[model samples]
Target chain A: MSEGSQGLLLAGVGGQGVILASMIVADALMRAGHDVKQSEVHGMAQRGGSVFSHIRWGERVDSPLVPLGSAEVLAAFEWAEAVRWVEYVRDGGAVVADVRTIVPPGACNDHRSWLRRYPGIDGELFDSRHLKTRLIDATATAEELGNVRAANSVILGTVAAFIDIDNKHWEAAIAHLVPKGTEEINLAAFRIGRDVAEARVPQTAPDPEGFSGPHQIEINHVWCKGCDICSRVCPEYCLAVDVDGKLTIIDAEACTGCKLCEALCPDFAIEISAPREPAVVGNQAAADGSTL
Target chain B: MTDVKTYLREWAMPHVLCPGCAHGIVLRSFLNAVDQLQIDQDKLAMVAGIGCSSRLVGYVDFCTLHGTHGRAPAFATGLKLARPDLKVVVVTGDGDALAIGGNHLIHAARRNIDITVLLLNNSIYGMTGGQAAPTTPEGALASTTPAGNTEPNFDACKLLMGAGASFVARVLAANPMDMTKVMADGLDHPGFSFIEVISDCPEYFGRYNKVGGGAEMLTWMSVRDEGVAGPLAEKRFVNHIPIESVPSGMETGVLQREIRPVYAGVRKVEDHES
Candidate 1:
């Protein structure tokens, strides 16, 4: 850790132009007459996996990896990724995160409750870390400027406000790195980001009613022909056929109320009933209503 | 969100279709479409000809007519013409509509009558103990063709499209949601709506062709679909059956839709004077 040396962290999901944004940042830093080194991990980026890059700049830079709790700022392209990499920023460091959520495929494993494993957009979490948080709807701003793909440039513009670099270097780097025809749009998006106001973060939504318990799966044995359609289509594997070719509920507690079995059952033998009582187990925040 | 069971004749529970037969799913999807459209159950006429698919009309609590083999279209056309307010739907099988009642089916389409024909093609004559039918793919084994039929199968969608059906579409039992969507679209179409549901006869077609059970048969159908890929398309269901036995590149979803004049029959004297 040398004096005047600062690290910047960028985290986002795949296909969000995380690598391209990092290259633009490093290029801007180079144009600002600083020693800049950038490294990124994007092996699983094409499959909608997590992508991150570490950028460090100073009079003399040794490593591109930004050690934990040493970054001056963290730019997250998605809500979940913001919460994931917020710890990397030092105390009182800035965090610029877009209020966009991309629910991953792995978060859908809990088929019993149908509750996503994503966190809510609560600024209190960052407040507890004693860090300066700047939430912005960069995607919306970029979309309003006529192209949603310029969202990363908008975020880079916001990051410029925190760094001591002049706007001319960022403009030059954006013009040099952006696609052949999108340079104008990217430049306009950057100016909007540089002067953008803090977006209003909404409160966490209340949990949906009548989702406290697993749904009840009723099977009419008389109508069921032991076809194996319901059991096979059940995402939770809640139903099965016995040795005597009779439908049976092997795991009633795992029913997610998805009703795929009930929908695809040929005999009308399967019926999914919601829990009889609307007991409030706990407050689970719903997904944010923000959109790009 | 009325329960589809409300439209069913509870006494007819446990339908006579064979185990793993997809006709039950088709019936449920149809009831869903009817419920979505909010059609009056009494004003809805379901006509069926003698076949495993035709038996679906007997289970529904509607103005149902069990007609002679391959004559469901004729019955539906007559019913629609007499009671123009009623929503007439004909449930027929591949053999009943394509083989035995081919003329009536084509004539109904040619007239551009306001009747929805849901031709459930299981690719075999399931009601007659798995005999070869007109829609049965070539080289597929059936009771009548133990050495594999040396004939080409009929593409039901193409046949209906060529017959001047204003609305032509195909769906599969494997994808019930899309089936419901296309079924609803067909019911809403004004004239000659023909939807061919690629249902599965696991007891007959699956066992004879070694395509596994109802679940495997659905996976096979989904794999062979050339329409927009769905969630089931990505699943690796470990199919061991030979590739050539099952038909491939069969496109699903709505194939054609057009606006045309509907055959409303002879108008009354008061209607002409007005």
Candidate 2:
């Protein structure tokens, strides 16, 4: 695991499955056993307004909301939205943006004219029409996979390729989160995305001083409701309840604080806290998603 | 009851709520009702209007509809009609339900849809800087009503009963015991059931009315009577004269002994409309 935290922002208009895509990424990270917290804003969504999600995954996450200007990955379904949140990405952060610009209302008399003002924004902008970008088009891929409604799954697959998480862990998380009868298509989309990200992302030298030291806990009793939801959705089966009805952490090392258990609990009796406190520092990274 | 601590998301959950806000109490009571009845988790649908109280839907994990201001009844109506198996509950503030959505409430009660309406009447609109609401007391001062409000307020339970609601009751948010009981009973009612909860808006209504703090607001509610009325009472008004007068044809009492035939019956005639 990296020593520092990783922040990702998912931005798009409502109904573009931005929330679902954000969930998929967060789910994959949790499966890899990384600490994560995600915050979603969706009020007045019926009016077709802009929507954004903040995801912080790594060592530990406290506040679900990330402070401005700390995103390492900014994935946008639309081009203008990508520019809108371009300032959040830290220097050297990766941005995998879609270039299929759908002009928002009041941008201009025409949509194309409205889109011309965006290239000036920073970061490596990938044309959404790029062959690699096909994985980002989950809506199209869902249809190809025999269900037009599974488009959000496609974008998740595209995002899988960029982060440092493992692919099998993500596959297992998808298998857990998604409904049955649609696993094959989602896995295919995810594999394609991994291949693309591996091809495009440059390999960085690993930090010798990665996360280390006394950051672990021994929870005596975990009163999980025996609902297979956690076991099903977890990429790592770190969660288990012994015969005595106490929940057990099978692999404490692999329990990411994604708080998916908190989100999905029907009875609502699970708690997960970050193992370590996070520190903030000043950096001169360009506001755009780049390594300038 | 599901322990609130366990159900809540651990993230610094938004502390947007003001101290001693009635919306929180209303939300707690609501959760209690659902827990006590053991309502099928998947079958519970909540509809909310726009107000401090309406925002209650945001924190909850159920299938919630944060519809437009004052249109929760209309939305809940459509939701219940489409999915008859689902138990729909509408939570609205006084302003949202009586002022802007008065017509929807009247029609829903008149049609008697199998929906439960939790009307949180704090007598002021807390979300929009504490303005005068339809239920604001005749002489109560508000942000909009500098001197005092001159308009009469609607008695939600009485209005619903007169509009043909099958079940009606009123309780104060201060009395969690009775409030939870009334909520459960309303949800169990087979037709449009109206339960008006006298909630305390400590931030706006309380400070403006000089009712002290949230605890003081609850104290005010504790002294009030449950205004129970008889069935054939010739003109039982919601308000008493001398101190102040507001015209409300609703008397405090149960209206119907049994649930009358409603839209569901009409649907039955048509073999159920989807």
Query: Which candidate comes out best when scored by lDDT?
Result: 1
Go through the candidates in order and give each one's C-alpha lDDT: 0.85, 0.64
Q: Which candidate leads the pack in DockQ? A: 1
Residues B201-247 of candidate 2: C-alpha lDDT, one tens digit per residue: 77788788776554445445544433422221222221221122222
Q: A1-292 in candidate 2: lDDT tens per residue?
A: 2346778888877777778777877888988888988999877555656788999888877766656666767777665676687677665565665444444444422222333433333323433312223214444445666765455565666666667887787888878776687777767765655554322111121111222211243331233344333443344455665676455667766554554443333233344554565312122122222331
Q: Is the docking of candidate 2 incorrect, acceptable, medium or high quality?
A: incorrect
Inter-residue clash pairs, candidate 1: A266-B25
lDDT of 1 at B241: 41
User: At residue A115, what lDDT does model 1 achieve?
Assistant: 45
Q: Chain B TM-score for each model?
A: 0.92, 0.84
For residues B187-254, what per-residue lDDT tens digits would candidate 1 score against the true structure?
Answer: 98878899999998888888998888888888778767855334455554433544444466788889
